[model samples]
Target: MIAVVQRVYEASVKVDGEIIGSIGNGLLVFLCVENRDTDDKVTYMSEKILNLRIFEDNNGKMSKSLQDINGDMLIISQFTLAGDCSKGRRPDFTEAAKPDAAKETYNKFIEDVSSKINGNTAIGIFGADMKVSLINDGPVTMIIKR
Candidate 1:
């Protein structure tokens, strides 16, 4: 599993002109499941994301976790994270999980994340054309893989 985490002042996902999920003062997570990903992978990733100390502290140092700040979370499924572009002009997604497996893993990941946070979890449709908008806070972004 891989995730691109971005701190955002606000974020939203729209499908067919209808807003499906949105959040404020939180993290926007673009998650991808690989062919070998399992519940254990999701568990590890969720724990890391929830406890990651990317937020700022009193002295303006990045020392606070999302839980510390009571922030929100917006998760979106992005199979392209597994794209391999090493040798060819076109990227290959052979490492990405198949649709069925991806959907199941995606749903489980969301459930795991939601269980950690209070009540601020929002998610995009697993296989939908989504338009995501966000005002990135501090321009803080990090990528994690496991």
Candidate 2:
């Protein structure tokens, strides 16, 4: 599993012109599930994201974790993150997990993180066309893979 996590002032997801999920003062996570990912990987990734100290502390240092700040999370399914672009012009998605398995992993990750966090956990539809909007706080982003 891979996650592109961004600290955001606010974020939202829209499907077919309807807002399905949204959040404020949180992390916007773009997640991808790989073929080899296991439940252990899901738990590891969730813990890593929740404890990442990207948010600022009272000293204005980047020392606060999302859990420390009680921030929200917007998780989106993004299999494209697994695309292998080292070959030809067209990227290869062979590393991405198959749809059925990927969705199950995605949901489990969401549920695990949701159960551990204090704030909201918003999600995008597993296979739908989604539009995500956000005001990136500090434009801070990190990629975690497990």
Candidate 3:
């Protein structure tokens, strides 16, 4: 599993000109599931993104977690995150899980995060051609993998 997490002041996802998911003042998560990914990886990534201390506190230090700030989260399925470019100019996606399997893992991750955060978690549709927009807070982004 791999996740590109960005702290954002606001974020939204659109599919075919219709807004599917959006969030305010939280994290935007672009996730990918590799062939080897399991439910455990989903759980770990969800927890890590939620608990990361990347939000600013009263002292202007990045000391607050999503729970601490009562922030929101937008999760998007991004199979391209598994693109392999080591060999040539054209990226390869053989490492990425098949759509059927990847959607299952993506749904599991959304379920896990929703169970933890309740109403604050939003998600993009799996396998959709999604257009995502965000204002990255502090441009604070992290690439997490397992």
- Residue 7 accuracy (lDDT) in model 1: 97
Tens-digit lDDT track for model 2 on 1-146?
88999999999999999999999999999999999999999999999999999999889999989999999999999999999999999999999999999999999999999999988899999999999999999889898988
The candidate 2 region of ten consecutive residues with least summed lDDT is 137-146
Model 1 Cα shift for residue 53 (angstroms): 0.2
Model 3 spans > 4 angstroms off? none
Model-by-model lDDT, in order? 0.94, 0.95, 0.92
lDDT of 3 by residue, 5-97 (tens): 999999999999999889999999999999999988988998998898998999999999888898999999999999999998999999999
For lDDT, the strongest prediction is 2
TM-score of 3: 0.97
| Colliding pairs, model 3 | none
Best by TM-score: 2
Better of 2 and 3 by TM-score: 2
Which candidate, 1 or 2, would have the higher TM-score against the true structure? Answer: 2
Worst 10 residues of 1 by lDDT: 110-119
**Which sequence of candidate numbers ranks them by TM-score, best first?**
2, 1, 3
Cα error, candidate 1, residue 116 (Å): 1.2
